[model samples]
Target: MKKNTLTFIFAVGALIFFSQLSAQENPLSVGFKAGTGLSNYRLSGDMKSFTSKMSIGGSVGGFVKYDLSSNFALQSGIDLYYSTSKLDSKVDKSSNKLKSLGVEIPLYGIVQGKLGSGKAFIGAGPYVGYGISMKSNGVNLFKNSNEAGKLVMNRFDYGLGGIAGYDFDKNWQINASYQLGIADLLKGKGGSMKNHGISVGIAYKF
Candidate 1:
């Protein structure tokens, strides 16, 4: 319920932003992109006191973009991403790390402006991801109280994202973006954990 509400709000907000910024329609373009991402988990609710270190990962994907006007466009893409995080506690003498891989889909509403002879774009939207693999290394503080579980994370992840980029030419683009997770990653959790991160990459349109 909370996850659905947040996703819906983000989608609607992107639509409203796009509608107001669109000016002239342009043709569609397809592109490929690859980049590195840095991520970490934010534990909230009952787990607010927990601490985690940032994770480093990479993403490779393809995207399609349709220009709503000369200055606005909509973009969607699919990417395979790898994420990891290290967890620790101050009061409790325990430590753990999580590693996961997933597929992500992002729907971004973009606004473009002239930058000298090139173009600059900024986009924001919502993204949803499904974990292909996830595991944790630490004591299974729940079941055995000494053994780690095989898989400890939920499959679905949803959040809000924002991206900004510049086109150096008709074919090359450089961009950076961030994802703020709203859904809890742990399934049947004693607490809540969410993934959030930033990515910087390059893209080529062909």
Candidate 2:
């Protein structure tokens, strides 16, 4: 687990470095995005005593995108994201809305084409997020364990995600994105968990 986390961090640094080198030759754009995110955990492995609820959160980030061609480009950025969900434990007769804060590295492959007065585009790629903190009803839940049934949270996560948006003009755009979490976020034994996050919002280019 430590190796994986270190590798992920190294990869993020390498990507940003390469993007910087490419910026000199390619048409590059720097942008900021802000939006609302909806997250839900898919539970598995005999969840006979728990109930799950969807959480709504917010996301804000900046990105650097380099155009490889008129129709293709690559974008990567750092984002701070948040999520909170209610977990009901029937066995313990307890319930709490757990909140988590995390940072993400998003790499997107963008495809573009011209539309009436603007551009229409779509992108798909991968993302890695690391948990910074977690709390349930204001109590810390970070046990730093990945074993099942420990009721602890995992700090590392990686997944495939995609984005689609419309560039209204050169400086502004509207977009929607989704992440299909491929990692197990729960380290406890009773069940496994996968996260699904969706968001919609606006972006600005500079």
By lDDT, the best candidate is 2
lDDT (Cα) of model 2: 0.84
Runs in model 1 deviating more than 4 A are 1-26, 138-151
- Report the CA-based lDDT of candidate 1 relative to the real structure: 0.82
lDDT of each: 0.82, 0.84
Candidate 2 per-residue lDDT, tens place, 120-187, comes to 99999999999999887555667654444446778899999999999898889999999999998877
Residue-level lDDT of model 1, residues 50-140, one tens digit each, is: 6878978899999999887677789998999987777777667577787777899999999998998789999999999988777665323
Model 2 pairs in collision: 147-187, 148-188, 148-189, 149-188, 149-189, 150-188
Point out where model 2 deviates above 4 Å. Answer: 1-26, 90-93, 144-150
Q: TM-score per candidate, in order? A: 0.79, 0.80
